[model samples]
Target: MPSSAGPSIDTITEGGRVTQVGEGQEAEESVPPVMTFGAPTAGEILAERYELVEHINNDSAGRLVWRGVDVVLRRPVAVVLRYPGGDSATEMLQAAVAASRVIHPNLVGVYDAIDEAERAYVVREWVDGQSLREMVADGPLDPGRATAIGNAAASALAAVHATGMVHGNMHPGTVMISQEGRVVLADARTDGADSRENDVRAVGGILYFALTGHWPHAEAPLRGATAGHGRAAIPDGVRDASGAIAAPRQVRAGVPAYLDDLTMDLLDAGIAPPPSDVLAAELGRLDIPIEEEPYPEPAGPLRFAAETGDEPSPLASVGGRKVAIGIAGLLAVALVGLLIGISALGGDDDPLQTEPVARPSSSAPASGAAPAAATRKLSVSDVRIIDPDSKLRDELGGAERVTDGDQDKGWDTDTYTQPNFGNRKSGMGVWIDLGEEHTVKSVQVSLSATGASAQLFAGKTDPPSTSAGDKLLFTSYRTNPVGQPFEEHDGTTMTFNGFDADAKYRFLLFWLTALPSNDRGYQVGVLEITVQGS
Candidate 1:
């Protein structure tokens, strides 16, 4: 006899057995076909430890995902159950075992795999987030956000590729973003059905989807993604009547050319996909930080060999600086020569200047070069907060506060529960637009508190509404206790230097990567920004 509080038992007269009854009972009882499969009901415990609480959704691969509880541990879990399963059970278990062997922050952890003869299920960590497919259901994503998502996926796939294993299945359906702003790849099906190139290419597909709201790769096995009228078709690229898939820029207005090229290159079957590690490295390089590095003093200018054997050359003892300056000079001369040739072609041929003009002296700076160690402070405009959540955005003054040359008045970030901005969003940043591009030498920042860390990033394009990693300049960053000057640490001043003098900087961003301390809660004030450039 079962108590009223407990689950009711139902007798299957045909099998002469008593079965537990719950949500799926009616469906199971109505089925009189030869292959009678019993559906798992709510509160039914499988393997004695997992209790199914609610059905989430069925995957395209024919797996039922249920929100369940580990009866033994009392922890929530996701249980993927497959019914009327035999060979599929074997494959699922194998995948579970394979996935379990490789542990990565981006991968969903497998807890257990078991079969009950009639059905099979694989228990895994429950992610508190939405899938990539769900994210773009409303519309396309920002290119920078899309690129960041792809970078994370590529990094995770690189780890799997390192072990000679493949994710086998890579699609928007498998990408997940937690509530804390962490991106992770999930539901890996490693059956060798897909090649490593396919995985890499899928990353491009993700980018395209994020940029265009449509999957570019027709062959990607994603639900709600098809090739016909509005969706991308299989195998062939996302195409129109012209039989060519439009580049991201063609689909959207603000997608950067570099990003468009990278996405197209990945989707183009004509081009071989780069190795996963190489792709990861490329993305890593493009991710620019906005924080400044302590700028060291400039090295000496170039020197040359002395005409007389006994006399020391003016450029002697020029070690590393020599090579850098030499390269710069050579490049300048080549550019000048090319320009002169073009000009000569367009003008009347003058025999007096038939030959190329003499190149600048090895010791002399190029005609266009700024005075040695010339520095200028730039005034930044259009400062803004980078919070992604519109409702949660903090109110701050326009770009003028930090540039007003007033330490007493600065911009403060919204207080967060955790040092890392509570992981609810990527860390906030203060972005500034230089009126025009310049050859930057270094940047100095003044902050209200210590221990906050930031990296500097420069790009011609407007900084995206979010803090994008692909636009970072150098990974080298600056950090310290704010307002607390120590023996060598100037508590109020954070200096960033060693910028590549050859590269030009127009728009600058100072993005915080970590908060100094949560003792006072997570917030930092941008007091001032002093840029050194020409």
Candidate 2:
């Protein structure tokens, strides 16, 4: 997923069952269209043709794909790139064809762009299953299905911010979970459209990580702008217009205080809450009332070999790639970084430095070469498992490593303490297991706590009996509003199409209100959890 500007907007992931990052199709293409992560993977089949079917990753900015389609549009279409460097493939094919003429369904469908392959892609609809950050589990959802999946993905971000445009990076792995129970939203990279306060903190962190697994907005206390913000609290050019909201049950408790006050007026209102009518009114509040608890069958996948370490820091791998999220548009360009890489992502310029760099120290560096290390390869011994328990072995820290699969490393309670919902002051949670059944796609957590930070959950069980609109697991969280903890949180590894390969689970949640006055609290550790081998 390149686009650090040496390229336009790279992103595209394949095999986890299709990801996007290839867009820029419109410089009169006969056929040059092909790019995956360096930003621009597919679209403009020019006239029906597709093959590539392999290589599932790249990151000098773009590449990470799979291909195989030939005709009546049978299948294989996930591509999203815009990597032609410093704009122009006609301005990234005019922001992916003005986000494919604002079609809205959680947003993701640009279809073409390739001024002779400088690049641009946007033709997604792949999703097989798994993502909400791999299935979320530190707990949170069912506040009427997290406001019916956050007001149907902010009603497809108010129909792409009402055409003035501005999804500018929402989260929850860009949102997608299809096997049937659809909920899409894909990578919609934007360079402009007034950034609608960064799409209202990416739709209020996509409904606060779909009912709280994590993500509450933090470019580190607004990084440098006091009068303007981008990730979670509307403040730029301004305009929820006046919808006004702020109640997710004061912040979580089995949710439903009128869906936490209509998802806080669909995120501090100003108007916006229609995503397919809030996905049919939070999926019709997915039939509630369940205090019993009894739904098991999760335990899958386990092997272990992981050495695949990487990520010197392109902000430690720009969240995961793809950047146009929604109903299933699925995005991942909101690690929103540049502490020093500068401007390419707001650091303001400097960009990685080049040639096997060095000196950074802790964002990551057991070895070296960082700067989005060409696209983080996943760590923590490649974390073979972290959901409902499926077992895979390696070094694990910060505790809580259960396994209902059998009797290997069964333990629980490494940490969990969500007493308040103030979005800060204190928070903790932990769980991990993946021994047998496997189909999970992604999950990565690493925040030590400048104040505090971390959220990645995937559970069908392990303290999560069900609810959040049952079917097992589905939740997400993102925070770091100041609580630093080495800082390294990403999203959308929460997907589900297969689980209980033996039992899988993993939770590492934390948030410590602005601590010591406005200092907040957030501490993190447990450097890796990279998984993907099919």
Across 243-353, the per-residue lDDT of candidate 2 in tens digits comes to 222234334455532333333333322222223333333334332433334221111111111112321212111221111011211122221221101001111121111
Which stretch of 10 consecutive residues in model 2 shows the poorest summed lDDT? 351-360
lDDT of candidates 1 onward, in order: 0.50, 0.33
The residue-level lDDT of candidate 2 at 471 comes to: 18
Residue-level lDDT for 34 in candidate 1: 22
* Stretches of candidate 2 exceeding 4 Å from the true structure: 1-89, 92-112, 115-123, 126-144, 147-179, 187-189, 195-534
Q: How accurate is candidate 1 locally (lDDT)?
A: 0.50
* Window of ten residues with lowest summed lDDT in model 1: 338-347
Top candidate, metric lDDT? 1
